[model samples]
Target: MTRSELLNDLEQSLTRLVDGMLVDKGRSIEFLTRLDRLDDIAIDMARGINADARLAGFFADNTPWLLDEDLTTAQKGRAGTLFAEITDLLAARTDEEGLKLGREAEEWSRAMGGRPLRLVLRATREEASLSDRFHALLRREAEEVNMLLAEREHLMTCLDDVLSSAELKRDRMHHHLAASLIYFLKMEGYKVEPYVRRLRRITEILEKEKPC
Candidate 1:
């Protein structure tokens, strides 16, 4: 495909992924909760900006300054002008209304702590975490897949023998096999939690929506 076509295809895939995620009620609720948190954060930021009277920007009521300690009088005056502009924008609304929104936002922030936008976006958009060591470890383990498979086969054989032996009880053998399976999967760089989660979700849905 052409470069533009390839980019379009990737965008389509991402759109489908997002759509599927939103289709689930739980996931949609989770997204809405995040948005609410973002709103609260934005409001808190606006309050801070109004209170500081320095470090002006386009959206003067959105975010705060980097260095609050060393703002010049001139900078503060500039910030005052920006605040005046913001006040003009909110002129139709009473100060009481603005204060109410601020109080509500503060309460909401208390209810659900602060999260910077960058961190939130990183959490939602990224697949792999930003840990080089984790990526390296995953890569190393993946490279040893064949060796891990061999080790797993050996363990399975031993587990079979243990289960069949007269001296071993069924429960003991099952426990040993479970431990071995866990170890083997870890060694092979396979994440079993997602599969377990899928099974649990299926079981929960089935139980809740079973035929009456």
Candidate 2:
């Protein structure tokens, strides 16, 4: 594959894997394994790009930044790459398989600009506390949702102690984007009661976990 083509494939794979994590717990292992396979040296040499090194940079970045309209075309690609890199690093931990989850995430990001949904609070990108706060508040809530899903899925898969710190961080990001997206729609007065209910269930689940 050409360099650009390889990059495109990488993006799609990363996007898919990340997307899978957000929506489908059953398939997460498959996505992660794909990510690990793509980490191979032969693939990089064939494409003339060091996939491992390129993906390493992704681990240090945040997923929401990928959606910032202010990012240059190049910057968006970099952010996407970083997002994928992080996914790859994370997926390496378990039943091991991994890509293709990005389109839905992008759609939600566009929802910020009133795409398919009105905005009560439009999310804008700037280097400021307000920008950070918008995502931060929703992200914390999102993390709760992720924890619930992760726990339930772990029970279903019977996978134990498979998560690393890096894995948890990646998991948080996926939940944030998904939760923040729903919260954004809620801000618009959209019909997000289902999401709100699903999110609130996290609290009840946690309550059950506390020492009695």
Q: Predicted candidate 1: what Cα RMSD to the true structure?
A: 25.3
- Tens-place lDDT per residue, model 2, 173-206, is 3334445555666677767675556444544544
TM values, all candidates: 0.18, 0.25
lDDT of 1 at 25: 43
Q: Model 2 residue 183 lDDT?
A: 61
Tens digits of per-residue lDDT, candidate 1, 161-185, equal: 3233212222222233344454676
- Model 2 alpha-carbon drift over 4 Å, by segment: 1-80, 83-170, 203-212
Where in model 1 is the C-alpha error above 4 Å? 1-94, 115-212
Q: Compare the candidates by TM-score and give the number of the best one.
A: 2
Q: What lDDT score is found at residue 174 in candidate 2?
A: 32
